[model samples]
Target: MTRLRTLLVLLVLWCGVAASALAGPIYRVTVDTAALAGQGGYLDFLFLGLQDAAPATATLSNFTGALEGGGVTAGDASGSGAGRVILGNGSGWNEFAQHVGFGGLFGFDVTFEVGGAAGDSGTNLTLALLDDAFQYVGAAGDIVTFALLPGQADGVTTDGNFATVQAVPEPGSVALLALGLLGMAVLRRRSR
Candidate 1:
């Protein structure tokens, strides 16, 4: 019975450690397309691609747009046009959206399917630009996807971390975890 109890406790502790280590990455990518808007032609186009080489590509869905002062009334199409291969990975493409009129900005969330159970730490945002006439007229605007490092709350923006992410250790969380483990040890000793 004592050995069983020790085994159970060890299993629980191992599970806790494994769970924490297994947590993956999730990013809320907000693209400020206000700059891209009204550049040459009407900025009515779609941007879509995968974060990694996974067959499952993430889609930036449910667009909500606005102009500087007024609402130009635009919406998302099903990205189903003669889209060209945007990413150099030979990733074929199709129109993801059209009539996404000139707006203040375009925001989309790309939840990365990262490495292992720890999830994707980073992925590339390979985008192709199409004209108002469904022609691949512009260059591919490829950018890297980044998420704010763990335990950070403010000050840093997710935008600037396109190239490299500054990840920091959460000291408070570590301290709390240590305290909890110590308390658990005390309880186990008392029960014994």
Candidate 2:
């Protein structure tokens, strides 16, 4: 009986420890499109794992005009319709937080300069975080996604970037934990 009780206690403690250790933090994802142009095309922003603590902001670091090469469609049928523009070289920064029970939140702010001759010069930015499969993980896995609008503000902006707390357990780990608990229970019953 004493041995069974000890096993039970150990099982419970293990579960608690696993739960706490698997707990992830909250993240905020944002996208800014202040330097992009509508004529040159739009830009897509992607984020992996972002925390959702506070002060979620996405800052645009650099912007370069699209490239000109052969086999390029003059008017591509893309989402923006301003034609496809390849990014030269740019960098940006994003920040967020992580907490227990809460998934994460993220924000992004991007700026784009419209092409001077296109007459469709505006910024189009989008901020988002996606998993390995590119699936939108609003409140599940560790990914965030952001979308920016053209001709919009040139600074950081917040949107409906909130996710619920999700606690997903691994199949193997859960099975092991359950088996351990069940073993303790069975032992207790046999001893009694």
Candidate 3:
């Protein structure tokens, strides 16, 4: 009976530790496109790539994005590569006039998972607005390059240009800590 109890306690402790350590951090990246709304074209492409990132230290995965404000109507597509995410809207070959009439201040909300050591940091990604031909709009601030550091918020903005990196709070670690304490208490009581 004592051996069974000990094994059970050990199992609980291991589980608690595993749960807390295996979960990675989630970041919320927001991009505002208010500046290019009336620039004679609709927002066609939003690219999050590692073109200028520190590939050795930075890691990102599990991407999800959404369009906001009064500008998002119809026609949207998305895809992901090894370390990049591509979002598109409107017809191709149309140049930078996809949503010329649908011009309205809008923003993009992107959430992704990241993993890196405490000191691991740098520009991990860049957010770019491109035309149907995948050419960047010939305007300032159309390309916002930023980093998503652990436990820190980051942003780059210009002419309504904005990007915020916010970490999603996780309670698993706290719950695991509590579980560990409870297991320890029970084990002590049994020993006594």
Candidate 1: residue 17 lDDT (0-100): 65
Off by over 4 Å in 1: 1-13, 36-95, 114-125, 128-131, 134-140, 143-192
Q: lDDT of model 2 at residue 181?
A: 83
Q: In candidate 2, residue 6 scores what lDDT?
A: 76
Which residue runs of candidate 2 sit more than 4 Å off their true CA positions? 1-16, 23-45, 48-168, 171-173
Q: Estimate each model's TM-score.
A: 0.38, 0.24, 0.42
Clashing pairs in 1: 79-95, 79-96, 114-119, 114-120, 115-119
The TM-score measured for candidate 1 stands at: 0.38
Better of 1 and 3 by lDDT: 3
**lDDT by residue (tens digit), candidate 1, 1-192:** 977976776776676666656543333434344445565322232223344432222344333444222212122223321222121212434223334444244444333223322232222333333456644433344333333222322122333312123333434446448856885887888889
Each model's RMSD to truth, in Å? 10.2, 18.2, 8.8
Residue-wise lDDT of candidate 2 within 78-103, one digit each (tens)?
11112222321122322221111112
Q: Write one digit per residue (lDDT tens) for candidate 3, span 1-192.
A: 989987987897788778766665445554454555544433443323233322222223342233322232122223322223333212221111123322343333344344444445433334446554546664543544444554455544433344455566556777777887887888788789
Q: What is the lDDT of residue 58 in candidate 1?
A: 36
Best by TM-score: 3
Off by over 4 Å in 3: 1-10, 38-123, 133-160, 171-192
Candidate 2's TM-score: 0.24
